[model samples]
Target chain A: MKSASFHLNLLKDTERLSSSPVRLRVMLPVVALFACIGMGLWWAILFTQLLMVRAEAQDIDEDVKAKSKAHAEAISRQDRVREMRQQLEQLTYYRNGVRAIGKPLAKLAEIMPLKVQLTDLSFAPPPLDPPPKPGQKISPFAPMTNVETQRFVIAGRTTKETPVVALMESLDSAEFERLITREKRVKSFRQDATAEKGGRRLLAFEVEYTMPERRFAK
Target chain B: MDADYTTVARHFQVNAPWKSISGTEVPSAHGQTVVRPRSNGRPPTGKLPPRLTGLHSLAWKLLIDLMVKIQLTRSKTIEIGFGGKGKSASNSKVDMTGVELFSGESRGAPAVRLVHKKDGWHILAAGFVPPPNGDLPQRWEDTPHQPVWELPRNFQSPSAAIAVNSGMSSFSQASAEAILREMSQGLGDSRPKPHTAISPRLSLKPQAKAEEPQKPAPIGRKSTLPPPGTPVSENGRRFSMRPLAEEGFHLAASLPEFQALWLGRLLPEGRRPTAASIQLAESALMASPLLHPAFAETKGNMLAIFVRRDAIYFAGYRKGEPVLWRRCPGVKGYDAMRNAIGKALGVEEELINDVLEDALVDPRPALEPFLHPVLHQLDLARAYLAGKHSMDTGKALLMGLPYGASHWCHMAEESVKMKLVPGHPFDGITLAKGVDASLAHLHLVALGAAIAAAEVET
Candidate 1:
């Protein structure tokens, strides 16, 4: 038989005491207080970080809004620049179409024959294109072709057609190459409205000559 | 007509009948009277007389029930003592201290520390500590005072068991043998001794045997008490019981409700040893001899007489289980015996030990007056065991008395006709270095308290 069979203990469970010096009763509250304080400090740190991050996010949002508006304005200015460039390029084409007519006129005078008394000398431009239709838009600054033909009509009391022909042949020479082309025509010779003092009734003649073409280029 | 007996009356009305023909004579057909037993030794084999059956049983049951109810009512009203409420479950490595308090002397009481290591218990220390100077408070409202004893470093342990000798604590015991004897006074069942010799079976396989011996009755079959661990109240006292190995036998102990709380908290919890178990002094004394070799040699069939300063007690064991525990009424303890020896021989207090141990002097004049009644009671316990359990107690252990053991032994051999063997409480235990073995007798209750409190389950 075990010795417990003879033991008759009178102590109750509640009355038993701890022999150890370290008591949970005294230390429990202190440990719990420290735990609570530590948790509070940790939560405070997290709260501070959250506030700082939120402020940084707000600043970034405002900066993005300002940058977006500036970007839109820059794009509109780029479109306006492209439209002005196209108009300027058309104006440059008009400026390049000017013809040097003074040199050609001076050369025509020099190549005129002495026998041919020139009463009237003028250049008449050739009809180069048909008239525009009703609804078609035309740009005035650009010409259809840089080359042109002009008829040089010569009318005078030339007395005979030979003199006029001689004048035409002289106009076709290399000295008048920039002024006139080889092609020419004689129309009719008729007496002038009044005879010269010598009482000679001269026949009146008309001649036409082709002029060189004028070019417009860069 | 009583309200409490109404149920019993209704029970009898509904039941068919009950009859008792136990040990009655029957007339044979040949004109001769014969006593015949049933073939199966069972009840209700034949018809029985029914005239006074119900009335006889009803009257007896009512009387017993009324007595039990009155006892219970009285116990529940007022309890000023306490019972053991602390559990003794502990690790094998924890050291335990056991002490006996309020041990009749004002100065000090016995104390010891025990530990169970590799094989068995070893004593760390043994001696005495200051007593509780009658500071047993009866209620929680009472003012608390400083503890009388602070265990020395050598005796201090992780846990302590205290055995107190106070009027508030009580111990009692009863067995199935006692019940059997009461049921039939002189009808002794002297059974053959339990089979102790080895069996002669050499077969490799188990074989059925028609010649197997019978075993004793199952435990608690004839118990007259309540279930173990439950309290039983009688004569205005409440008790708690623990069952024994022997069938229908149990050891019961009790303490006042107030006293249990006080004893449990007597040792303040701190650096000093805390009380792990609180028990009565006699209850601890009952287990003092459990570690002795005599118990193991007899296979736990033994008896012991404990002589204390104030009282004498008898403890009986069967198969290491408690079979009997009784305090001798009217007879006093060792102090009374010593006083008687001193007055009879007219010797000084110091020379009293010499007269009893020295065969040169005849101290029968004083010894006979004290020993006759104590041994006569022991003989009665022995006779009761023989009639009921069929085991002969040839020798009984005597302990707790520091002197006059030889005289008590001589008187038993001469007048009582029983052998008395005095035992040392530390006989089967190993003592550590510096532990004094000579003082083993003085720490009987403390040693038993430690042994019982440090119960190692086998």
Candidate 2:
């Protein structure tokens, strides 16, 4: 006998209320509505965030465009400053290269034993650099290898080799060290056709001496 | 246990065959002819009938559909009414908890829980608890109190099938004789009745009885009673019935519409052990014998007498379908038998059990007075089933007597020529460990309510 045969349930189904406060019959639609609202809010927020990100990206792109020219100008000015500094450094090297030969030459006169009758006193420095070609861009900075070698020649009429040796020995003194070196060779020694005031038949001699190097540097 | 719900529903449909799509008359949900709108869209003729008030008729149809909805709640601990195919007598299925609420005497309701598992039915728990007070809502719009009764830890279930015994409850057929009796008893104090006559509610409310006799019943043939399975109100009484397994007959029940409304809302949910179904106490008692092993031995054909505290009832079953249910007229309950025994044997009322069981005191003097009427009524019922349905009432089963069942059986054999066998309420069910079987007699109606409510075929 199925119980349902005896089941004459007077209580209707609607009377089957919820045990918990949440009634599924009424709450299901309510929860669905709330879920729909929440999704809508989330979509709105996501769309707003996307718009904000797009706007920020555009602003950053425009800002970068606006600042690019100033950056380039600053870079050019910096390049000009660097060039001016390099030119000033080159000038300093030129100043440093200026040989203090005036004092040394003055001392050379004092050191020379009247050169036994001085004839020719000349410094044969290495030949000056070749000038720049026409239309060539010239750099103000000196070349890295700017040291020059010169030869100092002392040619005079002397009575004998002894006075010449004395003159060479006097040139070797410390006061003329920067101006002259020991590297020397006698070019000639011959009897002079012209005599001195006393008619002493003075021998003519020429001596060439290597001079110290002069360098262009920082 | 499987329910005969499909047969019952089909029977109801056949009895009220007004299911027509094109007509204005359609069958009501509860086996009655009612006027309703066309099925859908509009009639094929394209012209609206004058009687078809567009939205009103459509709304009525919607309302009827909504009210007739049947859904099986799965969340309930015992999936009540989860139908399956099988002989309901052998298919003692469902995990149900049955409780008789509002006991009407000290509110002492007995609770029984049955579960089908491991190839058999088990009595998970059977015990008595003090029933909580079930108060109806103060206003029609108010909701009843949830968690009205907090069952003990042992007796509790996720949901419960509730059986109630109310003074205002009545069960009668819609036959002419019964209607004539109803009309004759209108607005008057009548002889005692197992259902309405002796009810405390009726005796207390003479004014209600006076106020409700507005329409005199029809003399004959055109009975105003609602058709089977439909509820109808007349003379301040609400009546509903279901088609009987016996063809062309339906079993009817009545209650004060107020009491029906009250019982309907007695167990509002929102708490543990909410109600899964509700049934009349006598209705439950009538069905309690379905699961007994003896029922199967009898091939689902049997007759049984149910003895309650205040009333005695008879129920007959044919192949597990209830065919006969009646309250024995003029015969009172066991308490009256006790009163007769106390008066005839000059014994104290408390010692009535002793006198009846001892057999030392020949209390047949008092016993005969009580059993004579009951036995006569039983004989009439047995003869009726045999003559009408060709069902042999073969040695009717006696149940819920509490005591003196043997004496009653002996008397029945001698006087009525019918053998009476004592029935155990839990005979077909396996008792779980620690379950109290001693009080099984008290849980008859509760157990029946659970079984019947759970047996609806899905």
Candidate 3:
């Protein structure tokens, strides 16, 4: 009875295998192959997309750097231009000032009497204080010297007997301050009289005076 | 019922087809028989028709043609009332007979007819109602008539021709006066006659002739100057004379002074004067009474005069040489110096003190009081740069940073030195870094102030 049952089961199994032979032959390999190919294609697409993204990022970085450099250069050039314009303006101002002083000086010369003449006419920047001695470091907190006061000096000469005192008074009247005199010397000379009678003594003097520093005080 | 049936049949015969039981016979009703209407029917060949061909009709036709050219169309239809009280009634009686006409025979028949009633004509105008499709009207050679009153020519006047030819209105009295004045001025012959009241009936021909002789008077005396003492005859005329000190003296002075007078005054305020202004002033002053050849030579060194708010400022080099002098303490702690160098070369104590202060301090504050003089010095520096001047770059930078004058002098010097090589000066000036920064700051401040003022005033 056992042998018979076993043989019967074997027969049943055989029948089952024979019933779906075509499905077994065709369906299994096709499904497996399709899944493999699909996975491979998906990986290729993802890799290509990643590479494109990286390239675009690099291009953007380069563009940003280039723009920053250009901006910096433009700023520098503008700074340079502004400096030049200022320098030009200052020069123009100075030129005009010199011309102004010259005009009045020329007028004075034209109107001056023959008895008076300027032996020396000089203009200098106001006198400056002596620079700090070498080998000594200056303290940062110390006040710097103001160079505003010592910028100009004027000196000249005139005829010996031209009433120097009266001339000084006139200058004072014209709003100039007088400086302390360093020297005043008189020299005597003998002059021939027009008639046969006599010789007369003539007096000549040399006077020197310093100019006070106030007229152009700021 | 039989009578009603006959009446219905008669009404049907008048509006629809009339036929016998065989569909071939014509129905006759009210003692009338149906007859076919003639294609080329004449209006009983009687008396002559109303004449509609004349100049007036032609004008109407022309008006219609112009309307068609401009694509104008009657947007609304005009209606006339008829058959009312006092209206005449028609005498003719008509009877209806039903008959069907051949469709082919009516293809080219007149679409409308004019029926003359006892009162007036009634027109049965007919045409095909266009399809509802929204197509635009097509261009065609022939168009409908327009009313005579709509013509543009009716509004034009005979004087329009004169306006078109002269490029001005003939009827404008102002234009006539302007023309007469121009003619008088151009001819330099006739004194301008006092204006007289124009007669309404004055002839245009005679007036035109009168205008011709007055053309030379204005032309002969082109000199804008009237005789110096001639009292101005006209109420509006006022002669202005610039002061001898300002105009005449400047004219007799040096080119530098002349240039200063012209360019300094004429320049637009708040901005620095340009090189072009200087050049222009130079040329103008050359022709002025104040012009001196010696001034031309010293122009490079002459001080610049600047007018600010209310006062004129002068900036220049001070010729400071010591001579016989006296020192007196002026009102405050300020010491006054009185020096007699020459007859007119007296040095003021205040000026000496200023020089001393400038020497002791940085030149910046000392230079402040003489703004115009500083500007003049700047001009000289520029001139020097154009010639030959040494540049100390580091010193220039230091001076320019604190004081404007030093910077200007430095740049001028730099420009001249850099010019040793062709185009080098331009490149050097452009590349300089220190002075440009300060100049930009000043300019920005000025511009901001100007903008603020403008906004406030507006």
Candidate 4:
């Protein structure tokens, strides 16, 4: 009798490899071969390009060097121009500063009453603003620095307070007040205590005012 | 081992003179009567009519001629047995009147003995025997030795008969040799294996029954299909997307075939693409690049119709790069068209002959209904291209119609003119060898994709 092995159905549920190992073996070599060829061609083309670039570079060597030198010289010249511009701005700022002070000083003389006697005059710098804290909203209109200010103090004894008041009114004119207040030009103002002077039953007072400091472009 | 069997055959010979029977005699002048059997060999003893003789002769001639013709036409010779060959036991001859048996015995006095029966002839004796000394023979073999049934010495087995019928003389010899060799080999290795039972690895087990069907998943789920313009994995093909040095540009390449398509990012990479991306622009990003060059060649904004067996893919390109891709069902894909063509062409559903042929000749009729949907798709694609890709529609729209569908060029151009500039893509780009008008038009999508892919910054 024949063996029962013939009736057996082996290989059930066994999965066949979808991608053949033989195919992979063949494909890997073929792929590698093609890849090598591709790389060879790529390198060949790259070499050719490099050679061409080198030839072009050699051809334009002097011209490039000359252009580089010219570019460096132009940069230096631009730096000099920028420095001169800064200097010119500073000079303008100084001139403006002197004018600002002179106007106020000249106004003080014009505004003073004939009965008022001047004892002393002085100047003080503008007050510094505190640095901003973290997360604090800074106002755009706020002055960035205390570089723009002209503060002055005037001391004199007047026989009557009317002249002093008149002097204060004269100084409060729109032109002077605008310069001192609108620009945050006048940071502070105060009147010192009165003092008797020269046996005229006179009252002595000291007045302090600030005008905007002069600024120039940095 | 060779096996043998024996079979017996019997032969007999007989003759009878029944044809000499006297017919009815009539009284005539001088009392003379005639017997007609002597004149005619047939029992109906009379002269045959001339017409009958002529007819018989004609029949014989025709038969002879037919036999000759048959002999000439066939490779083998035609033979009609006429009782000249050696006789065998089973061989017998019959005629219209009675049957005749030829004698087989060489020892007996040659005598023809014929038996006459009402229906047929039977062997009466081997020959007429005159008893020796006029004494009746007592023993059965004594009277006249009748031919006894003799066993045949040779009778072929079934295998031998098959071999003989097959005209292979060596088959039986080879089979005998093989059997003997196997026997010798088996005898030489008489030892039995330790494990006569079936091996565990070779044993069979009952297969598991199929499980019940699972519930359907929720809708709006992402499909396994790749996003439009993204490379798809195909059997025997590999597609990989490589980023170009330029931002928002990618090269999708398939190796071994070297089919490449260029992808322009409408949405940035790494983001999950929308359903629209997969449906509208899948072929553009994922399809082969053979479709891209026409717009580049035409150097204008254009809509390209790529006709395939199952679907017509449409893509609009600006400046030689594909902006959108859309797939419209081909006539072959429709059940109605498929059934109609199947019946008309007498072909299966898989056969796309009629659909392709009709589209080639005059597609306007069959494709008329579907063109609206295609037009809608094109409108959507064009809208997307214009709205998203910033492609200008004002430039002349060049239509890349298939080579076979050139008849529809004017109609397509006119239909598309309402929405786009319809021109030929071949007007501008210089075609390399093999990218002719026909191929460029037919596979506009693939070519466009390829051209776009090559543009990658690599």
Candidate 5:
């Protein structure tokens, strides 16, 4: 049995030595190749999935951007439409206001006396005097600028001596003003042939009124 | 008549007598003066010819009738070329009872006495006689001898006869001399005075009275007339003083009406209608009479309303019939007319309003009629830039064409090979994407062609 056992062991050792190089060279390389192929397949699948996900995200991002742009454009268009509507409305309102005040003003103009002619007329919000300067701030003791009284100054030429009084009376009685705060008259010689021949004088007058604001509304 | 003639002859003899009066210048048997001729019969045959019967005919009477008709009533009368040696003397005897003078005496009745002289018979008043011893003796016949009745009274005045008469006419030189004598005798002591009253008054006054009060002698400086005031209204509102070139609407219950309210309100007092108003009326007439036919029918009504509105508007500006258009506020004739039109057409007012509003706001009409076509071309260019339509046909077709054409077969094959080089690498991407890419490339080429075509068309 010992001799048989010794022969078997020798055979086993030879087989092991020859197969070990073959296994190292052939089996290792084949297994490594199969393993590499499997890993490559797995990575490719992952890469494909990653690519799909990225494409989806890009699509979502583009969709959001497009929607946001469209919304902004719609809002802009709405804003333009609103602005146009407001302009048209304002124009209509102005036209109506002009129409409303047209007749009364024309009648007033017609009844105005021949000697008086209005050189200028302006209509807008009443002017507001500038606020006190920073350095010139009002103190408790400082007198006010008389802001309580709103003045309407009427300046005109007159060939008559009493034109200022007549104008004041007309304005007072005609209900054109609530009050006549002040009346000023200055006499000046008019170089007219008739006036100079008669040696008559004319008065250039500036009359100021502090009228009630309610009269204007009507 | 005989007595008058004798008296006239006696006066002639007294005035002028021949020194050969011893032939027997003596008183008649009844103490009337008488003169005896030196020659007792007709002159010798050579010295005087036989009278022709032609002179005795009524032809000379006809001439006398013509002369009396033409010259008796004239302002001045004259006669010329009288002779007594021929048949003319006999004719003169028949036509004119006047004094006659001959070269020799003729035996005849004392009523028709002939004096020895050189030439003709001349008619004279009974009171007039010639000088017997001077050249010829005068024979006087009975005829009215009033000096004032001799010629037309105008001839008796101190006026000149412009021309002398010749023998061819009845108004002759001898007749002219007699007329001048009568006129000179008639003009006694009368003088004419014209412009008697005012002329003396004006002349007696100062010469400078005609130009007195020379406008105060133009004082130191030239005076200026008063200036007409502001062309526009003094109020803040501007007065139109006329209608606009295009009529504008005053909205009345959402309807456009021919309301002259704005017009009346805007015009200043005593403002005159301007040329703009006339042009506005004309333009309104020339345009479509009715705003649009789709809105209304009965164009006459529309025109009437339009004309009335214009008339009132213009009248307000003119200040003529000023109160005609001053109705209650918000009253609109145009709206009424529009409603009437809608009612006539069996349509609702709202529908008409829609139509009118559309007409008012339609940019199509505003652009087509008012805007030039070049503006439309610019719009098309902008649209083209916005990728609404392609600009080329051949390139587009070539890009779209599959590899089937005969001439481009090689190029098509090369394209296919390039596409297939990756062996279906382009699987997931759509074929349309490739087509779009190709089209984009073709579009570049098409842009050039389109520009060329557009240039040609322009």
Candidate 6:
């Protein structure tokens, strides 16, 4: 019989892995120790930096806070100034509208014939006949639009139809064309017989024209 | 349904020793020791075997299942501690007689016991009650204080105490037999007894039988009465006789058989059958007389250098125990060595060294080149063993057939500077039989392994 022999693979297994568990046991503690040391060092650095940052922050705290307060006050003053400017602009827009009405009124006065007698002058939309319902849908081709387009209405009495025709020609002049379209200058014109004024037969009339719009400065 | 059993609970009222009493501090006496119980109160048990610990629970279960299927006894034991948390000796609720209860100082109130027997675990309640005096344990003081004992200057930690205790215990029980027993236990009982006697074999050769009859006993006793025809003494006690040359014949005769057995046994199980043959050629070297000096000089701290076709195996033996083994790769086999020689000799065909008496041709140049690389590796191997394992290369016996080739043995001897011996192929027994030297050298390692195995077996 042969003497007892050992398998090479078996021998390798016995010797090679014999110290593996021991190595792992030792390595774990070593790794943990290094990690703990690294963490401790990192914490120390962070804490020191925090202390230094806190000191510097304390020194600059009052300066920064005062500067911030002043900045806030300046911002508030700037907002108030902006509000005043906006109010002045709105007032200017209104004043410009009043001034614009004076020129148109002067022009209207120049255009009026002596035979014409004005009873009422107003800035309003022409009254709609049989006002549309709230939910009514206008035809796509309809001249009425969703936009609220204002118009000027004038109600007066004229002595003759000739003065009315002359007044319409004067209003359609180049100077008035800049303010209003001549084609739609008089939205509606009506003539009616009224009681005689100053021993002459009078023609009562109503006229509606495009309303003036005020354009503000950019 | 109304049950007769009713639970009764009572809380013990403890009396205070003092009402906020204060005492003056006093110096403690020197050399005074205090005995404190461990926090867990659980003694340390030895480590669990790696076979159990290395495997996962599922793997263990599978192994157990397989064993059960095969009807094999379970070789594993899993420890289960049954008790209340941190409760040791007092947890078990065994039957207590009246006398045992009265006499026992450690008797506590009755508690449930979970007993593990041959069948399974069983729940039990001890039939004992607490003493009627209402004497309960006092609360432990949690004040921080100095330790009870001072450590020796050398003692590093409390865990080292185990090693110290073991050292002390071993020191006290030290003896040759104890040392041997411990060595045997630690090394496993597989080591061979080198000096053990072999079973004598009956002489079978015709010349040996004639020579045995002719040779007289070295010592003789005179007898007055007519001598018995047989070589039996007058007291009728026969004497065992054998030629001195044949004393270790059985050992030499059994080497080959044992070598074959060891080769088979040492082969790794579950490996592919055709991977490689593990040649054990150390039998002749082991059985040679040259080994006796080395064994004596180092007390069996011998390193066997086994050269094979595939690799060079380095094994360290300390007192017949295989302490370490390392295999160095890239060793050139005999075929390669022979091819190199044939090429150097300008021979077109294979040259077989067949003559028994002719002078052996010198293939030194061809062999040296091949051997130089091997020697370099050997040197590195020695350095590794010395640096890592603390093995003294100078003290270890270096024996291998590779060293015997040409001037390689002398070269190794000079380098290692240890008790180096070129292993001869045969001992006295084989030599007396006049076995061919060529056949002996061819199977040298196998013969050495047999002898080594025989030594271990003996």
Give per-model CA RMSD: 22.7, 16.8, 65.4, 47.5, 75.2, 31.8
Instruction: State residue A71's C-alpha deviation in candidate 4, in Å.
Output: 4.0
Residue A174 in candidate 4, Cα distance off native in Å? 2.5
- Chain B, candidate 1: TM? 0.65
C-alpha lDDT values of all predictions: 0.63, 0.66, 0.25, 0.34, 0.26, 0.35
Model 3 chain B: lowest-lDDT 10 consecutive positions: B158-167
Residue A6 error for model 2, in Å?
Answer: 2.4
> How much is B410 displaced in model 6, in angstroms?
31
- In candidate 5, how many Å is residue B146 off? 99
Query: What TM-scores result for chain A when each predicted structure is judged separately against the true chain A?
Result: 0.52, 0.63, 0.38, 0.51, 0.37, 0.54
True contacts kept of each: 0.47, 0.39, 0.00, 0.00, 0.00, 0.03
Runs in model 6 deviating more than 4 A are A1-37, A56-68, A88-110, A119-151, A178-198, A215-217, B1-458
- Model 2 alpha-carbon miss at residue B401, Å: 0.6
TM-score for each candidate, following the candidate numbering: 0.56, 0.58, 0.17, 0.25, 0.17, 0.31
Per-residue lDDT tens digits of candidate 3, residues B231-337? Answer: 11111111111001111110000111221222122212211110111111111111111111221233312222221111222211101100000011111111111
Please list the residue runs of candidate 5 whose C-alpha ends up more than 4 Å from where it truly belongs after superposition: A1-62, A89-101, A109-153, A159-163, A173-198, A208-218, B1-458
Task: Please give, for residues A66-130, the per-residue lDDT of candidate 4 as tens digits.
Answer: 79988999999999898777667656655554544456567767777997888877766556767
Model 1 chain A lDDT-worst window of ten: A7-16
Show how many residue pairs clash in every candidate, following the order shown. 15, 8, 117, 35, 9, 31
TM-score of 3: 0.17
DockQ versus reference, model 6: 0.01
Give TM-scores of the second chain, every candidate. Answer: 0.65, 0.68, 0.15, 0.29, 0.12, 0.32
Candidate 2 lDDT by residue in tens digits, A1-218? 45445555554444554333334555568889999999999999999999999999999999989999998999999999999998898899889888787888887677566538888988886877777778877675775457978898887887678878887788878888888888998888888887755767788888999888888876
B1-458, model 4: which lDDT tens digit per residue?
11100000000001112223422222211122211111111112122346556778677545533442211101111222222211121222211000011111123211111122233322222222111122212222343532221111111000000000001000010111121222233211312211111111111122311221133222222112122123333332223232211122222222211111101111112121100111111222222222224434455355555443344555554444333444453333234444444565566665544454554444455445555565555555565556655665532333443332333344445565533343443343343233335423322322222222222210
Give the worst 10-residue stretch by lDDT in candidate 6 chain B: B159-168
